[model samples]
Each structure stands twice: as C-alpha cells, then as structure tokens.
Target: MKKLILVRHAKSSWEHQVTDHERPLNERGFQDANLVSNNLNLDGLKPDLILCSDSVRTITTASIFTSNLNIDESKVIFKPELYDFTGGNLVNAIKNCDDTVGSIMLFGHNHAITSFVNTYGHIYIDNVPTCGVVVIGFLINKWKDLNKGKTIKTVFPRDLRSSIHSR
Candidate 1:
C-alpha cells in the first residue's frame, strides 16, 4: 500500500502587498501548521518523501512542519507544477513520484487539493482549511498504480479535534 499526505499551504499574510506566490505565512498559519505537525507526530505518521510547491507560503509551511517533525530538508522536492490550481496537475505530480517511496507528502494550494481529495478520498469534507493535512491510503502497492476512489484513510485538523475530545 502507498500512503499519501496532502497538505494545504498555511494561512498567508496580505500585509506585504506581495503576489500570492510570494506571500509568507501569517502568525496564525505558523501556529496552525505546528499544531497539525504536532498532531501528526502524536499519531506516528511520517513521510519518506515531501513534495512541495515552490511558492513561498507553501515552502515556508512545509519547512516549518518538517522541522517540527525532525525530517531532513534534503528529502523534499520543490516543484513548480505543484503550484498549479487544477487537480489533474496535482495527480500527475503524485503519479511521477519515485516508486521506492512508501509514504509521500504533498504541500500545495487548493481548489486543487480540495478537488483531488473530494474526487479520490472515501470521506466527504466541506473544505480543506489552511494548514489542513489529509492522509490517504491507497491499496495499490506502487505509486504509479494510484487511481480515483482508492483512499483508505482521510483525516484533517477538525477530525483530530473530535478524536481528542472523544478520548
């Protein structure tokens, strides 16, 4: 089985008047990213490969979370196509990943992320909020074999809250 984690870039700051790609993570985004990272750590889910968009906000968010998780930055790849807004583009990027990687993490924007998750995941999510992380488990043994409707696990920040509250 192949495990995939889709992470939306954290909340961004508009105070700099910069282009969307150049916008940095806001304070709330930083905290939320850390919260997501901490929650994932508590769940013992770690990625072997991290694919992130080159956009500043996405890159920063990926960096912070990986740092918090003690993951090496060298395992990350910053790709331009991941910055695209279409779900097909994101799917293609994921399909191109190395087969040896058992677990992969993708950091990008949405509606692509939301569309991809909704199209492929088993669960229905209203929205993929900033700093949201969705864990998808595919039955296929290889990354290249991934297709629509193969999700086994779908989780987000709000789900974690409910799980914690229930405990």
Candidate 2:
C-alpha cells in the first residue's frame, strides 16, 4: 500500500512587495503551521519522501512540519514543478515519483492541492485550509497505478484550534 499526504502552504504575507514566490508566512501562518504539525498523530505513517514546492511560503510551512514531526531535512525535495496552481503538474509529479518510495508527503499551493485531494481521496473537502493536511492511502503497489484512494485522516488548523479553545 502507498500512502500520500497532502499539505497546503500556510497563509502568506502580502505586506511584502516581492513576487508571489518570495512571499513569506505571516505571524498567523507560523502559529497555525506549528499548531497543526505539533498536534498531528502520524500513527506510524512516516513519509519516505517529502515533495515540496520551492516557493517561500510552502517551503517555510514544510520546514515547520519537518521540524515539529522530527522528520529528517534530507528527506525533502524541493520541486519547482510543484509550484503549479493547476493540478496537472501536481498529478504528474506524484505519478513520476519513484516506486521504491512507499509513502510521500507533498507541500504545495491551493487549487492543485484541493483539486488533487478531491479527485483522489474519498472525502469531498471544499477547501484544504492553509497548513491543513490530508492523508490518503492507496491500495496499489506502484505509484503509476494510483487511483481513487481512501482518505485516511485530516489535520486542519481550525479543527485543532477549536479543540484548544474548548479545552
């Protein structure tokens, strides 16, 4: 079985005059990233590979999860192709992933992230909010044979934040 975990980048700052690719995460983004990552229960679903968009916001969000989850930094591969907003490039990237990898965690932008999850995962999430994580499990042995899979779990910042407030 192959497991695929999708993560959307945290809220980016619009205060900068830089291009979209260079925009960093804002204060709320940092908090949400840390909160969600720290609260995640991986349940032994350690990723063999981490595919991340090279954009600043995505990279920073990935960094927070890797650090919080204690995942090795070496496992992360920055892919400029993953910066794509459309799901096409994102689909190609996942399909092209090495078969040797049993599991993959991807960090990317919206539309692509949300679209992929909706198409591939069983759950119909209207939106995968910033710093949100959706874990899907595929029954196929090869990445190339990927098809509609079960949505194993989801860790959204809002869900975690709501629990915290209720406590």
lDDT of each: 0.84, 0.95
Cα RMSDs of all predictions? 2.5, 0.6
> Where does model 1 exceed 4 Å of error?
149-167
Going through the candidates in order, what is the number of backbone clashes in each?
0, 0
Error (Å) of candidate 1 at residue 116 is: 0.9
Worst 10 residues of 2 by lDDT: 37-46
Q: Could you tell me how far off, in angstroms, the CA of residue 127 lies in candidate 2 after the best superposition?
A: 0.6
- The residue-by-residue lDDT of candidate 1 on 32-76, one tens digit each, is 788788767525667889999999999999998889888899999
Point to the candidate with the largest lDDT: 2
lDDT of 1 at 81: 88
TM-score of 1: 0.88
Deviation from native of the Cα of residue 86 in model 2, angstroms: 0.9
Alpha carbon deviation, residue 124, candidate 1 (Å):
1.2
